[model samples]
Target: MPNLIAATYAPLQSNGTLQLNGIEYYTKYLTHNRIKGVFVNGSTGDFVSLSIQERKELLTAWHQNKPNGFQIINHVGHTSLPLAQELAAHSIGKADAISALAPYYYPITNNNLLIQYCKSIAEAAPELPFYYYHIPVLSKIQIDIVAFMKRAKTEIPNFAGLKFTENNLMGFTHCLHNSTDNQNIMFGVDEMFLPSLGSGAHSWVGSTYNQIAPLYQAIANSFTVGQHQKAASLQQKAIRFVEILVAYGSFLGVAKGLLDYLGLPLGPSRFPHTNLTTNVYSKIMRTLENEGIAPYLGNLP
Candidate 1:
């Protein structure tokens, strides 16, 4: 049951500071959704906008409220190593695992700096399993798969896995071939679940699981438990759902709407993200209705 089904939480905004509801709401959200773990302050959670203290609060809150048997993966990536270290240290005893990304909003050279950067953060939380989050789209930094594995072994001791979000299937094959001691490779995209799992992605963490966790779990079970056909059928349905949701607007807006529709109090995107158009909203709603997932919409406001 340790196989991870993690949710990326959007920190609530309050009076210019990120405010996460205390244990009550956090625990309620996880329990009701049957989530296996939490991935706070990750890309889907809008990690870029949160301050270090706010991120720490979210991590601590999850550690305190998460149901027994549930785990946490603290995402401590930041533009500065110092801040990343602070979050990592704060999560030392609080989270089961910790992950960090290549520093973004700046240019970087080779896999050397990226490896060194992740190594420094992992060192801060030596006892926790560390995962390297590779989201090339946002970070603008790509690590050579082979180079990363070679350096990780020498420099990062507690390195446990990686979140490879790149959609290149060929690239994924190459990375798995480069693993040492069953190093876990988690796929980050929602729509690629089947192919990713088929290609040997042992674990995953993503945003849509907040609302569509059951569907994701079904897809995973189908493949792992001798229902390949069922998994493929469900995978097609899930991908179609993801495509329609994203088509309605920016990924953040659509995801927030889904969270709201599910009666989760995730609120709107903090800022720098725009609202969806009326036509797109109507179209999305129609798609939901057609797909029979409207019952989960509950009492959306």
Candidate 2:
């Protein structure tokens, strides 16, 4: 129950300016729904796209104005150790805890490499709890989860838990069951919430929460209170919206489009990630219009 529901804040723009709504909308979303946390600079937050200074600014604003009682989990993953360390240090006093993925765009060896990398980071900010991020699809280095957990417990005591973003929920569940039950486990996939929770997931980080936080809160609490049917129904709604978005284009573009529709100045995604094409744009607009997702856009801020 420690700020269980979290929104992944994505800040990307062709222009130099960071859209303040990327910050404000989530803060306002949290306030409106009485949700508890805001996760900044994660995969959905587009952490790798922003400069260190931009990441710092977003974190600063969240620290300053996040609704009272809301926890902030800052993702500080970077290819450079120095930069990652500096960002981890910066996030220490600003947020409740922090996270970092296995260094991306590089081939890595065994769990030892990951253990050493995470330990070095854990050593840098001894004051804050550092959650290890596991997104093999993005990082390309799947640290054997069981092996990583074993080493973390013995080597880095400051190593708190994991933000598992892999598509393999069953495998992740096996890892969870095989490891220490006390270690906190947060699910990364938005669509797999119910199964993950049923499998004993404790926390979650999702991009869709940025848009439909109240609905997620309802689903999460519904599960907690033994309302599995209701939780599934709510989660179904979330999945439906996500399907529509993906059918239009990439998840990132759809998320950005949602933000844009909300009146936020969050511009288009970076190159190699083009905006929706004409036909796709029309389909997205039509889907949004049909779904009444516009009302939720207004609810964001």
Candidate 3:
């Protein structure tokens, strides 16, 4: 079975304080939905907006509260190499694996420099598996994954794979097919996951999995049974759901708001990401129910 790893949100209080209390419920919510693992401190967690201390605290809370058998892949990527190394070292024993994105401020256009950046972090957490988070749209360092894997093989001993977040399936496929080590290249685009599955992708990491695990799970089941039509229909619904929510406001904030309906109030999104007001959430919920997408959501407790 493919791994469903949720790129979790950083829970916050109304005043925008870190609400570690929410991790307990967050764990239960994901487990109930059959999510196998978590990708914390990534895009969904608003990592760029958070302080190092808050990120560490979030990691500590997740480490403390994560259910047995649940995997935690803490994202330790930072613009500062030293900070990234520090965060990686901090996850030594707590995280099941650690991942870092390419440096974005002064993007590493060269694959060799990217390898060096990853090497530094991987060495910091020598005991943990390391993944390079390859989201070029965000990092602006659109290097070839196959080349990165080739270099990583000889350079970084702890390199496990990539949190493959780009939409370039051709490159993604090459990484999967040509990798000498058979690394864990997790697909990251939530809306186009079915195509990735068609390409033999067995693991996925995305924010939508946090809310719509059952919908995607059903899609996977349909595909497994050779029900292509059913799977495609469900995939359309998944796509439509993203469209509807993204239309409301900041996609991340709107998604975080939906968590409240799932019985976990994750609070408002941080700066630059608009948090949905209660009225807005109510209207969105009503629209979802009207559109027949509410049944795919987690049950309200």
Q: What is the clash count for each candidate, in the order shown? A: 0, 0, 0
Residues 215-265, model 2: lDDT tens digits? 666777899999999889877777877888877567776766666655555
Looking at model 2, how many pairs of residues clash? 0
- The global Cα lDDT (0 to 1) of model 1 is 0.74
Give all TM-scores, in the order shown.
Answer: 0.87, 0.85, 0.97
Range of the 10 consecutive residues with the lowest summed lDDT in candidate 2: 292-301
Model 1: lowest-lDDT 10 consecutive positions: 292-301
lDDT of each: 0.74, 0.74, 0.89
Those runs of model 3 whose alpha carbons end farther than 4 Å from true positions after fitting are 180-182
Candidate 3 versus truth, CA RMSD in Å, comes to 1.2
lDDT of 3 by residue, 73-166 (tens): 9999999999999999999878999999988999898888999899999999999999999998999997767888988988999889989998
- In the predicted model 1, the residue pairs found to clash are none
lDDT of 2 at 22: 58
Q: What is the model-wide C-alpha lDDT for candidate 2?
A: 0.74
Error of 1 at 233 (Å): 2.9
Assess candidate 2 and give its TM-score to the true structure.
0.85
Please say which candidate is ahead in TM-score: 2 or 3: 3
Query: What is the Cα-based lDDT of residue 31 in candidate 3?
Result: 88
